[model samples]
Target chain A: MSRRFASLGLALALVCGLAPARESAAADTYAVDAVHSAVVFRIKHMNTSHSWGRFNELTGTFALDEASPSQSHFEFQVKTGSVDTGNAKRDQHIKGPDFFNATQFPTISFKSTSVAKGADGYDVTGELTLHGVTKPITVKIVPVGVGKGPTGGSIAGIDTSFTLKRSDFGMNKMVGPVGDDVWVNVSIEGGKK
Target chain B: MSPAGMMLATLVLPFVSAGLVMIGAGWLGRRLGIERADHAAAALAVGVGYVVGHAAIASPTFPPLDVTDRIPWLAGLAAILGILESIWPGPSWTLWENRLLLTALVLSALLGPLFAESSENRPSTVCLVVYGLIALASWTNLSGLADRLSGARLGVPLLTVGFGIAIALVVSGSLALGQLSAVLAAAVAAMVLLKLGSPMLLGTVPVMVATFGALLLNSFIYAALPASAAVALVSAPAAFWVSRLGRMERLATWKVVLVTEFATLIPVGIALALAFSASPGYAE
Candidate 1:
C-alpha cells in the first residue's frame, strides 16, 4: 500500500510539470519587426476631409499565449518626434509645443493590462500614455496570419485599431481646424524572439 | 458644448471668477480690518480661477494630481504667506529666506511642464539649467520693477496690458495655450482692480507671486511664442525706469501715468510685433 501511494504522488507531480511545459510551448514571445510594423492615425481636417499621419519609429515586444489568451501581454512605444504628415513644415509644427511638445514628452506608449479572447480575436485593455497623460483604453485586435518566415522563425501578424480624443491627452490646439477624434490603426508582423 | 463654446467658456470663466474673488476679498478685508487682504485675495482668486478654467476646457482624462495642477496650490500658499506678512509685520524676512522662496517658486514653475512627461522623456539637464536661468532672471527683473513702481497706480494696468497681448499671441498659435494665457491675463486684471482699491497691495508678495506665475506659464507651458519675444515682454516692465526720467517725478500724477504707460508700451509693442512675425501662421 505504501509503495502504491508513493508511485501515485510521483505520477501526479509529473503530470503537473508536463502541463506547464505544454502551456508554455504554446506561449511564444515575439519581437516587433519595425520594418513591417506600422502605426498610422487619421483625423478630420476642417470638418471636410481627413488628414493622415504615421509614426516612423516604434519598438515593443509581445507574448502570445495561445492556449490561455488571458496571459498574453504587449507593450509598445512610439517616438513623438517621428510624426510624419508628408509635410515637413507641418511636421515640425506638430512636434512643437503647440501639439506633441516632443521635447517635453518624447514618447507615446501603451502597455497592456489584461487581454481576453473575443469572438473574432482578442480584446486588449491597456493604459495608453500620450502627451504626458495616461488613460485606460481598449483595443480590438484581429490575428491576420501565422506562418513560417524565410529565416526559419515563426511570425505572427496582428491588426489593431482604436479611437481616442486628442484633447484627452492635452493636445487641444487647433481643435477647430484639426478634429479631436483621432483614429489609430496598427499592423504588426512580429517574429519569434 | 461646441468647440467654439468651449473655447469661449475657457476664457470667460477664469476672468469672471478672478474678478469676483478680488472684489469679494476687498469687501471682506474692509470688514475684517486686514489692510493687505486685497493682495492675498487676488492671488487666491487667480489660483482658484485658473484650476477651474483649466478643468472646464481640459479633457476628461486629465489627472487630478498632476504636477501642473500644483500651480494654483502654490499660488495659494504664496497668498497665505502674504497674509502672514501683513498680520505680523514683525522682523523682516532674512535675505536667505527671501532668496530661497524665490528659488522655490521659480523651480516649481519650471518643473510643471517637465514633470508632465514620463520619466524616460524628461528634458535633459542642460535644457533644465537654461530654463532655470531664464526664469530666474525674468522673475527677478519683473519683481524688481514691480517694487519700484509699487507707488504708481498705473503700474498694475501696464502689467495687465502686457498679459493681454501675450494672450492674443498665444491664442494665435495654440488654443489650449491661449486659454492658459487668457486665465493669466484675467488674474492680472483682477489684481489690478484690487490694487486700485488698496494701493498698498500693489507690490506685496502675493502680487509678485501672481506676476511670476503668469510669466512662467507663458514661458514654460505655452511656449508658442518665441523665447526672445517672451523675454522682451517680461522685461518690458523693467523699462518703467524710463518714466522716472529727470523732471518726470515732479510732473502731475496723470502725466506720470501717461508717460509710464507709454514707456512700458514701447517695448511691449515691439515684443508683440516680433511674436506675431515669428508665430507659425495662426494654429494652422
Candidate 2:
C-alpha cells in the first residue's frame, strides 16, 4: 500500500513538471488557426480585370520571442491542390501540369529566414516555394487586430499583401491573358499559448 | 504566346523536323552503310521533335524539375534504347533480359517524380504496384511487340492511339499534356508516312511504346483523365495484335493497313468518346 502511494506521487510530480515545459513551448510557437486564415490571390484576366482565387487548406506555426525579436520566425504551408477559384473546371485546369501540377508538388511553403519589425508591420524575408520552384521574397506583415478568447488565450490577427510574377516561379503559362503578375493577400488569426 | 505561335511550335515544327530527318535517314543510311539506320532514324526523329516542342513549351530548364520536364530526357533515352534494341543482334533470351532491366529504368523514370520529394502527395503502395505493373506491360515486349519490325503493323496502330490520346488529354482538361501528346503523335505520324513504302527494318517500336506509355500514364495520373478513358487508352497497344491474325496476314498491303488502323481505332474511339462525353463536367 505504501509503495503504491509512492508511485502515485512520483507520477503526479512528473506530470506537473512536464506541464510547464509543454505550455512554454506552446507559448512560443502558435499553430496557425487554419479556419481563421485566408490565402487569396488575383491575376489579370483577358487583359481586362482581376480574377480572384484562394487556397482552402493551410497549416504551419509561428514562433514569437518578445525578449529577442530576432528569434521570432514563421513557417506556413499551403496545399496547392486546395485551390478554390469558384469554377471547378478552371480549378482542375490550374491544378494540372500547365500550372501547379499539384499532385507532384503539393505544397507551396514559406519559411522565414529573417524577421525585422518595421514601422508598418514585421518585414519578413523568407524562401517561398511555389510550383516546385523556390525563391527568396520579402513581405510586410501588419497587425490587423487582437482579441482574448473565452479560454483566456490571446488571439493575433495578421494581414499581409504582396505581388509576385508567376514567371518567377516557373509558372510560365497563359501569361498575357492570365497576367504574369499575381497579387496575393493573406489574413490569418493565431491563438497564443 | 499566341495561338499561331503555339500551333507552330507544338504542331508544325515537330512535323517538319520529323519529316526532314526521316527523308534524310534513307539517304544517310546509304552513305553511312549503317544497316539499322531506320531504328536510329525513328528514335532520333521522336527525340528531336519532342525536345524541340518541349523547349518551346517549357523553355528548357536544365536538370528538369517536374515529371513533365523529365519527359524530353526520357524521349532521348527511349530513342537510344530503341536503336540499341534494333541493332543488337543478340539471342531472343538476351533481348528479353535487356528489356527486363530497361523496364525498371522506364518505370523509375515515369513514377520517380511523383514519389521522389513529397510524402503527403504519394499514392498508396497498392496504387504504385498497379501503376508499375501497367507500366511494365506497356514498356516490355511481353504483349508480343517484336524487337525488330518488318512492316508498319505497329506504326499504323500507334498513330491511331497517339492521336486518340492527344485529343483525349485535350478534352480532359490539360492542354499542356495534350499538346505534348500531339508533339509525340506528329513525330510518329511523320515516321509512318515516310516509311510507308518499305516496312523493312523499322526501329521505332520500343520508343513509340515508351512515349505512348509515358503520355497515357502521365495524363491520367496528373491531369483530369478519367479511369474508364484510361482503361480504353491502355488497350491501344494490345489492339495491334488483331492485325497479326492469320486472316490479316493474307490480305494485301493496303488492306492490311486499313484493317490494322480499324482494329486500333476501336479502343481509340472508346477513349475519345469517353473524353468527349465527360468534357462538359471537366472542361466547361
Q: Which candidate is the best by DockQ?
A: 2
**Deviation (Å) of B57 in candidate 1:** 3.9
Provide the lDDT at B30 for model 1.
Answer: 72
Worst 10 residues of 1 chain B by lDDT: B59-68
A1-193: candidate 2 lDDT, tens digit per residue: 9999999999999999999976665426667898989999999988889889999999987865545557778899999999999888889888887788888789999999988888887888999999888999999988677777677888877888999998888887667757999999998888875
Global fold similarity of model 2 (TM-score): 0.86
Per-prediction backbone clash count: 0, 0
lDDT of 1 by residue, A1-193 (tens): 9999999999999999899988667778788898999999999988899989999999898877777898889899999889998876567567765578675678899999999998888899999999878899999889898899999999998899889998887776557777999999999889988
Q: What is the Cα-based lDDT of residue B176 in candidate 2?
A: 79
User: In order, what DockQ does each candidate have?
Assistant: 0.24, 0.39
Q: Give per-residue CA lDDT, model 2, range B196-238, as digits (tens).
A: 6656333565566666677777777778888899988887768
Question: What DockQ does candidate 1 score?
Answer: 0.24
Report how closely model 2 matches the true complex, as a DockQ value.
Answer: 0.39
